[model samples]
Target: MKIRISWQGKEVEIESGSPGAVLVEAFGWKDPRPIAIRLGGELLDLHSPLNREGEVEPVFPEDPEALPVLRHTAAHVLAQAVKELFPEARLGIGPATEEGFYYDFEVPRPFTEEDLEAIEKKMKQIVKRCYPLRREELSKEEAERLFSERGETYKVELIREIPEDRVSVYRQGDFVDLCRGPHLPHTGMVKAFKLLSVAGAYWRGDERNPQLQRIYGTAFFDKEALKAYLERLEEAKRRDHRKLGRELELFSIEEEVGPGLILWHPKGAIVRKEIEDFWREEHLRRGYQLVYTPHIALRDLWKVSGHLDFYAENMFAPMEIDERAYQLKPMNCPFHILIYKSRKRSYREFPIRYCELGTVYRYERSGVLHGLLRVRGFTQDDAHIFCREDQLEEEIFRVLDLVVYFLSVFGFEEYQIYLSTRPEKYVGSEEIWEKAEGALAAALEKKGLSYEIDPGEGVFYGPKIDLKIRDVLGRFWQCSTIQVDFNIPERFDLSYIGPDNRPHRPIMIHRALLGSLERFFGVLIEHYAGAFPVWLAPVQAVVLTVADRHLPFAEEVQRELSRAGIRAELDARGERLGFKIREAQVKKIPYMVIIGDKEVEGRRLTVRTRKGENLELGLEEFCARVRREIAEKIVF
Candidate 1:
C-alpha cells in the first residue's frame, strides 16, 4: 500500500509504523523513542493507517508534543485497570493536562492508596498481554447504544452532544472507550507510569453535574524520566502556595468568611500593599488615569452590557434594593465604558485610557475553589482604552509592551502567548470580528512576538490575546490578556466626533497586565517558594539579638533600618541566637541583621542573607545596599 506523506519538501511512500526522525534532532534532543506521530496537527499512533497524510512528524519522548499523548494513553490504561478491579465503575471524560492526565469515574467510593497499587498491578498484567489498540468508527446512534448497553450513561450523555453523525471508539482487549483518534500503538507502550493521587471532580466541570472521582497520573517512555518527573512533583508540593501561606501566616480563607474569599494577615497585607504601590506608580508613569467604580451597579447596566445574557452563569445573583435590582460587579469594563460615555469625546481624545485595580465578584462553585488561585472575589488590574480605528494597533502594541514589563518585574521571563479568535456564540458582525482580530495580529507581529492561534476560545464579545507566564516549576499561569472589542461600543452607542464632525464608533481595547491580584500573588509564592525578593518581601530584614546584652543595639539597628524605608522587625526575645535565626529562616526573611558584642563594639552590622552569605557592613552602608536593591527591583 502507498502512503502519501510529505518529507523534506517531497512526497514519500512508506508503510505504517515507518521510522521517522530529525524533528528531535533539529531541537538538539537525541531521543530515538517513538510514541506517536503528528499528521497535520492531529496525532496518530505509529500503526494507525493514514487515509491522507500531509506531513508526518515522529513524536519522541523528549519532544514537547509527546507528554500529552503519552499521558492520555496512560489515562486509558488507568481506566482499564479500574474496570478490572471495579467492573461497575462508570467512566467520564479523561483529557490530558499540561502537567499530566486525569480520568473521572462514578465509583461507589473514593479510591485509596491501596486501590492505586492494586490498579497498577493489574495494569502491568494488561501490558504484558501486548494488546493492539483497535479504533472503530460507527454511527453516533450505535455508539450510544453500545455504551448504554454497558450501563455507561455518562458516555451516552457525551455522545448525544456530538454534532457529528459518526463517532470513534478505541478498543484494547475487552475494554472499549469513547474517544477520538490518536493514542499509543498498543497497551505495552504504556511502560513507565504512576498514579499520583485521587480527587473529587464534577462531571463536565459543572457543579450541578454528578460528582466523580478523578485519578491523576503521569507517564513517560522510560523509568529514569518518570523518576525525574516524580522528583519535580515533590518539589512542586514543597512549593505549594496554600501550605506556605498558612506556615508563613500570610493569608487564610476562614469559614466565617465565604470560600474563595481571602483574608490577608498583616504580613500578606504588607506585601499586597507594596504590589499595589508599585502598580499604581507604574500605571501613572505610563500615561494611565486611575479611576474608581462602585462595587454594585444597576441590573439594567449589565443587561445593556450583555453580561446578563452571555455571562449570567458566572455572575452572582442580583439582589433587590429600594425596589430595584442591583447586581454585584463581575467586570470593570462596562463601568469604564460608562465613564467614556459620561463626556462627549472628540478626535483629540481618541485614546482615553482608564485604569483601575477593581475588585469584582463571581459565583464560583465550591468544588472549584482553590486557595488564592481560583477565588470568587478578587481585584483585577483592569484597564480600558477607547481609541479610533487608526490608533487601535498602536495602542495594542503599547499594552503588550506594558505586559512584558510587568511580568519581567516579577522575574517571569518566559511566557506562552495565545491569540484567541471568535467563538461559536459571540456578538459583533463578521467584518468587525475580522478587523479586531487583524489589529491584534498586526500588533503582535510588529512586536515580533510569536503566538499560537487558539480557535474559538475568545470571550463572547471579542477576540483576545492571552499571555501565560511560566513559573520556576515549569508551570504556566495565565496572568495577562488584551482583548479588542467593537460590539461594546455599538451596544453603548459610544462615538467620538471625528475630523469631519461625524459620529465614529471608538474601538475598545480591554487589558489586564496582572489578571487578578490573588492568583498572581499565589503564583509568586510558588515561583519563589515563599522566599520573596527583597523588594517585594514583607519583612525585608529582621534584627536578631545575640543576647540580652544586644537588645539596645538590635533595637537601634531595626529602628535605623525602618527609618531608612526598610520594612524591618526586631526579634529581641530572650532565646538562643540559633533559635532566633532558624525562626527567621522559616519565615523566609530576606535579611537577618545580627548584632553581637564584637560587632556592637566595631559599630558594624553583620548581615546574613537568605542564601547564607555573610556581609559585614556599617549600618549606613547596609541601608544604602538595601535601598539600591529595592529601588532597582532586583530579584534574587
Candidate 2:
C-alpha cells in the first residue's frame, strides 16, 4: 500500500505495510532527516506498522515534539551501550526528560566519569554499526521467560507487572527491551550524542525502592545543533542562581539552618523588598486589595476546607498548641476563603479581588531540593477573586491581562498557555464544570489569546489555566496559574445576596501570576543571566574611587544616587579602581560611577556601564539618568 509522509512543507508517497517502514523510507531522504513522525496526532515510532490510512507530519529536530523523540532514542542508545560494556547490568527505565534523557540501571558498582566515557565510546561504535531496530510481540509468559533466561530480573519484573496477556519488545542487534515504542529506523540516526553525568536515582523515582545508577545524556540531529546546545548548557550553569546567590552574598541554605530553607542576607532581602514594592504597586493599580493571613491555622479550618483530607501529605506535620492541632499553611486558598466568608457581601460588591504575598510551607522530598527553585518554605504571590456567575468571565479576563502585563514587563513576551478542563474524578456537578470551563474559554477568546485545551488535566476541585513563559534560551517555565473553583465556595458555604433577594454561591478564581516568588526569582535570575534590568537589579549602581583623593566624592555620589532611589553602594575596600570596576561587572550592577581628581575638581563623575563603556558626566546628570532608567524599568 502507498503511504504519504509529510514534513517540512513537502510530502512524499512510499509503499509500505507499516507506518515505521514509511518513516524509514522518508528519513532516507536527505531533506527529511531528523524528523518526528506522527500518525493522526499520535506519535509513532519509525518501526510501527500502519494498520490504516492517516495523516502524518514529520517534525524537525528543533520542534518541541521532536526533542522528546531524539532524547528518548538517545536513552535507548545509552542503555544499549551500558549493556554492551557491563554484561551484568540490568535496565530499569530509560525515559526522556525536558532537558535530556536518563537510563537507570541496577549494576554492582556505580558508574563514574570514566565509565561514562567508555560507555559513550561504545555507543558511538553501536551507532556506526547502523543496526536496524525491529519490534516484536510475544505472550506475557514467553516475554518473562525470555528475560529471565537472560538474567534480566528488572525486565522480567516489569513484564510481570503488565496487565495484558501479550507484550511488545524492541530489539536492535542483541539488545532487547520491553517497551511500547516508535523508535528510529536504526541506531546510526543518533549522530551527535554526549553522555552528561551519572547520578543515583530510585528504581522508579520512589525513595523506598532500590537505588539505581542513572546515566544522563543528551543528543542532537547534527553537530552544529549539539554545539549550540552545549554552549547554552554552559551559559545556564554560569547563570545558575545557586552559584550567583552565593558568590554575590545574597542567600544561603545551611545545614545547621535546615535544608530547603533559605536565609536571605541583607542583599537578598533588599532585592526582595524591591520585588514586593513593585508587586504591591502593580496589584493596587489593578484594583486588587492586599490582605495578610496567619502562618498557621487550626486543623479544623483545613478539615472544613477539604485540605486536611486532600493535601495532608504535602502539608507540614501538625503542631499542638493549647490542646488543639494547628498546621503551617500549605496553601493560602482556605485562609482567603475564610476571609471572604467573614462578612456579608452583596452582588453589588461582586468581583472582590484579594491578593497576598503569603508564605507557606511544604514537606518537599529531600532529594529534590535545589536552591530556591524547590523549597520547603516560600511565599506565593497568591490571590483569589469572589464573583457572581455572571462576572466570572470578566474576572478571568482581568487576571489574564494582569499576567501578560507582568510577564512582559519582565521581558517574557513568548508564552505557552494551556486551558485544562475537568478531570474524571472532579468535584461539582456537570453543569458547574461546563460553566467554569466555558468561562475560562471565553476569557481566552475575549483576550484574543490562543491556548491549547488539556483534556482531563485539571485539579480534582476545578479547571485551570496555566501559563508558561519562554526564557532567553527557549526554555519554558510555568509561572502563572488561574484556577476556577466551584468546590471551595460550596465547601465553605460562601454566598453573597444578589439583587433578586436570594443567597447565591460566588465563584472563586485562584490566581498566582508569579507562582512562587522563590521559583520565579530563580527563573528571572537565569533569564537575564543575573544582570537584571535597571529597576530590578539588586545593586543598580556602584560608586568607585579612582584613588584615595576621590573617596569623599565617591561617597557623596553614592549617597546622592541612593537618595534618588537607585540601589547604589560605595566601594571603599582599598582596591584599585580597575579592580572595583571588574567587581561591579562581576556583580552585574547596571552602572558604575568612577570618581577621580579630574572629575572631583570639575564637580563631575565618570560613568562606566556594565558593558564597559565609559562616559564623563556631572553628578546631577548621572543621578538624573539613573533615576530615569530605574523609573522606566529600562533593560540596560
Candidate 3:
C-alpha cells in the first residue's frame, strides 16, 4: 500500500513497506529532527515499520506531544542506569506526567541525593551507547515466565492482571520493560534531562502493597528549553504554599493533630474569617439563603442517596450510636434535600436556593494528603438549587456569573472550563442524562464560555461543569463546579405544586464555587506568594516607633488605626527601628506607619506602603484611605 505524506512542506508518495527511518532520511528531517512519525492518528518511533496507508506527517520535537514522548524515553534511560549500577533492583511502573516522568524500583534502601547524582552520570553513559529500543510482544504466560526468571516479581504480578492474551515489552541493550510501544528510536536521543528527586511509593498506589523507591525526573529536546523549565521549577519551589504557610505563621500540620488536618494559627484564622465574610456577603446578595447542617447523620441517609453504593470506599467507617449506626457526612446535598422536604411547597416557591459552608469529612489516604489542598475535614462552599426545568439554564448562568465574579475579585483571570458528561455508572436514565448534559451545554453557550468535553468524568449522579483556575505561576487548580442532578430529586420524590395544581418534580442543581475553602486559601497563598492584599491581610498595618520618645505617639497611632477597624500592631519594643520594619516586611504587612519625632511634632501620620512608597496624611485621611481600600476589596 502507498500513501501521500507531508515532510518539510513537500508532498511525496511513500509505501507502507518502509520503516519510518526511510521516510525521515528521504525528507532530510534532521534540522528539527523527527523523533516519531504520526500516521493514521498514531505515533510510532522512527525505527518502527509503518503499516498504515494514510497521510503521514513527521512529529517534530516542537510538536505538542513531543515532550511527553521524550520524557517517557528519558524514564527508560533512568531505569537503564539503575540496572547498570544496582543489578539486584526490581523495576516498577514509570509513566510520564504533565511536567516530567518518574520510575519506581524495589530496593533494599531508599535513594539519597548522592545516588541521584550517580544515576545521572550513569544515564549519560548509557545515552552514549545508543541502544535501539526494540518493541516485542509475547503471550501472557511467556511474558510472566520471562519476568519471573529475571526475578521481576512486580512485572509478573502486572502481567497476570492483563486480560489480553499477549503483552508488549520494550528492550534497550540488556534492559527490558513491560510497556506499550511509541518509544524513542534509540537511547542516544536522550539529552537535556535531569533526575529531580526520590520518594517512597506503594505498588499501584495501595499502602498495603510493597513500597518502592520512586525517582522523578524531567527532560527536554533542547538545553534552553530544559533551562526554562528548571527556572520555573525553582520559582514553584519558592512559592510552595507549605513553606509560605509556616514562615508567614499562616497554618501548620502537627504530628499530634494528624496529617492532612490543617490547624489555622491566629493569623491564618483572621485571613480565613475575612474570606468567609466576603463569601457570605456575596452569597446572600445572590439570593441564596444560608443554612447549616450537622457533621454526622444516620447511616440510612447515605444509603438512600446512593453514596453507600458508589462511594463507600472513600467514606469513613460508621460508629454505633444508641444501638444505631451513624456516619460522618461526606457531602451536604442529602442534608439540603431533607431540608427542602421538611415542608410542603407551592409553585410560588418554584426556585429554592440554599447555601452552606458546611464542613464534611471523608477518608483520604495518608500518602495523598497535601498541606491544605487535600484534607479529610474541610468546609465546602456548597449550594443547591431546586427549580423547574425552565429555570435550569438561568440558574446555571447565574451560578457561572457568581463564579466569574469571585475568581476575578481574587485576581484569577485565566481559567479553563470543562463540560463533563454522564458516567457509565450514573444513576439517571439515558434520556434524562442527555437532557441534563444538553442543558449544561446550553447554559455554557448562553454564557458565551468555551469548554472542552471531558467524557465520562462527571459524578455518578449527573453531568457537571468544572472550572480550573490558573494561578500567577501558570499552575492550574480545580476550584469550582456546577452539576445538574436528576437522580437526587427522583430519589427523594421532591415535588412542588404546579400551575396545573399537580405535584411536579423540580430539577436539582449542585454547585460549589470554591470547592473547599482550605484548598482555595492554599492556592491564594501561593498565587500571591503569601503577601495577601490589604483586605485579606491578617495585619493590614503595623505602627512602628523610631525611638523611645515616639512611644506615646505610637500607642496613640495604633489605637487610632485599630479604632478605625484596621488590623494594626504596635512595635514599641526597644529593638532598633530598622529591625522592626524588617520583621513587619517579613510578616507581609501591607502598610507600615512610622511614628517618628517629625511625625509626632507635626501631629501627622507617615505611611510606608508594602512596595516602599511613603505618604504623609492626617489621622482622619489615613483612616479614610485604609477604609476605602478595604471596602473596594482591591487586589494588589
Candidate 4:
C-alpha cells in the first residue's frame, strides 16, 4: 500500500513496507540519530509494518520525546545485563522517568555497591556488542508458555492479566522482555550512561507484594551532556533543602515529634513570621478579609465538602470529640465556604474575598515525606473569592496578578502556567464546566500570558489553573493554584441577592498564592542556597568585634541596627574577628559589620557583604543602606 507522510515540512507518497524500511528510504539506514517514528501521535517501533497511511515524524535525540524513549531502552539494557550477570534473576517492570530510568528485579538479595559496579561493567560490554533489537508479536497462550518455561513468574503473571489475546515482546541478544517499545536499533546507540543508585521497591508499588531491588540509571546520547547532567546533580545535592536546613538551624524533622511534621526553629519561625506578615498586609491591602478557622471540625463538614468520598486517602482518621466525629482539616475550602454562608449578601457585596494563612493536617505516607516539602502539617496561604457569575473572570484575573506578584517577590520570575480541564469524575454539569474553563482561559489571555492545557487533570469539583515556579537551578515547584468551583457553592446552598431581588448562586474561586508555607520555604532554601535576601534573611546582619576591647563598639552597632528594625546579632563570644566573620558567612548572614580599633576610632563601620564586597561608611549610613535594601526587598 502507498502512504503519505510528512517529513521536514514536505509530504511524499511511497510504497510502504516495514516502518524501518520506509524511514530508512527517507532518512537513510545509516542515520544513527533517528531511532524511532511518530505516527498518528503515537511513538512506534521502526521494525513494525506500516499497516496504514498517516503523517510521520522522525524522533531525534535532541527532541523532547526522545529522552523517555532513550531511557526506556536503557532500562531494558539494564535488565538484560542483570540477567546475564545473574542467570536466576527475575525481572519486574522497567520504566523511564523524567530524569532517568529504573528497573526492579526479584533477586536473591538486595543489590550492593559492588553489585552496581559489576552491573555497570556488564552493561558496558552489552553496549559494545551492538546487538540489534527485534520485536515479536505472540498470542497470549504462546507468551504465557514462553515465560512459564523460563520460570519468569512475574512475566507470566503480567501476560495472564492482558485483556487482549495478543502480546508483544522485544529481544536483544539472548535477553527478552515483555514491553510496548520503540527502542533504539542497537545497544551501542546508548553512548553515555550511568547507574545512579539502588533501592528496594515493592512490586506494583504495593507493600503487600514481594519486594524487588530497583536500580536507578540515566542515559544521554552524548558524553558532554552526561557530564553536564552529573554536575547539575552534584550542585543539586549541595543545595538540598534538608541539608541546608540543618546547617543553618532553620528547621527540623524530629522522630520524637513524628515524621512529616516540621519543628520550626527560632530562626525558621522568624522567616515564617515575616512571610505571614507580608501575606496578611498584602491581602488586606488587596481587599481580602483576613479570617481564622479551626484546625479540626465536625466530620459532617468534610462529608458535605466531598472530602470523605473523594479524598479519604489523604485525610487523617476522625476523632471522637464529645461522641461526635471530628476530622483534622485536610482543606480550608469548606471552612471558608461556611464563613460566606454565615452572612446574607447582595450583589453589591459580590466578590467577597476571604484569605487565611490556615494550618492544615493531612496523612502522608512516611516514605514519601522529604523535609518540609512533603509534610503532614503545613499552613496554606489560601483564599476564596465568592462572586457573581459576571465577576468570575475579573476575580480570576486578579488572582493571576497576585500569583505573579507573590512569586516575583521571592525572586521567582520564571514560571509555567497550566489550565487543567474537567476530569472523568466531576461534580459540575457540562455548562458550568465550560463557563469555568472559559473564564480561566480568558483571564490568561487577557494578561497576555501563555499556558498549556493539562487535559482531564483538574480536581473533581472544578477546572483550575496551576502555576509552577522555576527556581534558580531550573527546577520547577508547584506553588500556586486557582480553582473555579461551581459545585461547592451549590453544595453549601450559598446565595446572594441579585438586583432582581432573587437568590442566586455565588461562584466560588479557591486560590493559594503560595500553596503551603512549609513547601515554599523549602523551595526558597534550595533556590537561594539558604542565603536569603536582606529582607527575608533570619539574621540580616552580624556585628563582629575584632578584639575584647572592641566589644562595646560592636554591641553599640548591634543596638543601632536593632533600633533601625534590622535582624542583627552581636557576636561578642570572645572569638577572633576572622573566626566570627567566617561563622557569620557560614550562617549566610547577608552583611557583616566589623568593629575594630581603627573603625571605632574613625567612628566608621567596615562592612563586608556575603559576596565579599567591602565598604567603609559611617554606622548610620550603613544602617540606612541596609534599611533601604530591606525595604526594597533587594535580592542581593
TM-scores for all predictions: 0.93, 0.93, 0.96, 0.96
Tens-place lDDT digits, model 2, residues 1-636? 776666555666766555455564654644656444677888877677665555676656666787677777778889999999999998898888877889999999889889989999999999999987787889999999999988888888889889999998889899988888767778888889888889888876677888899888888878898899899999889989999889887889999989999999887787788788989999999889999999998888888888878888788899999999999999898988878888999899978999999999999877678998999999999999999888888999999999998888789889999999999898899998999999999999999999999999999989999999999989899999999988888888999998998998898999999998889988988888888888887888888887787888778888888888788888877888788888889988888887888888888877888887888888788888878887877753
**Which pairs of residues clash in candidate 2, taking residues 3 or more apart in a chain or in different chains?**
18-50, 19-50, 20-46, 45-182
Candidate topping lDDT = 3
Taken over the whole model, the C-alpha lDDT of each candidate is: 0.88, 0.86, 0.90, 0.89
* Per-residue C-alpha lDDT of model 3 across residues 1-636, encoded as one tens digit per residue: 786666446766778656688787777778777889887778887756666566577887888988888898999999999988999999999998988999999999999999999999999999999999987779999899999999999999999999999998899999999987678888898889999999998899889998899999999988998999899899888889899999998999999988878899999999999989999999999899999999999999999998998899889999999999999999999999999999988878868999999999989988789999999989999999999988888899999999999998889988899999988787868987888888889888988889999999999878999999999878899999999988888888899989999999899999999899999999999999899988899999999998899999889889989999999898888898789888998888999998998999999999988898989999889999999989998998
Look at candidate 1 and tell me the lDDT of residue 487: 71
TM-score: the better of candidates 2 and 3: 3
* Cα error, candidate 2, residue 174 (Å): 1.4
Candidate 1 — which residues are off by over 4 angstroms? 1-41, 46-63, 424-426, 429-432
**Residue 64 lDDT (model 2):** 70
lDDT of 1 by residue, 1-636 (tens): 556677457566655444333333333334555667788877776546567647866676778877777777778888898998999999997888877888999999988999988988998888888887777877998999999999999999999999999998999899999988467767888889888999999998888888999999888878998899999999999999999999998999999988999999999998899899999999999889999999999999999988888889999999999999999999998999998889889999767899999999998989989999999999999999999888988999999999988889989999999999999988878888898888899999998899999999988889999999999878899889999886788899999899998898888999999999999999999999999999999899999988888888888898899999999999988899999898999999999999899888998999999898999999999999999999999987
Model 3, C-alpha of 78: deviation from truth (Å): 0.8
RMSD of candidate 1 to the truth, in angstroms, is 3.7
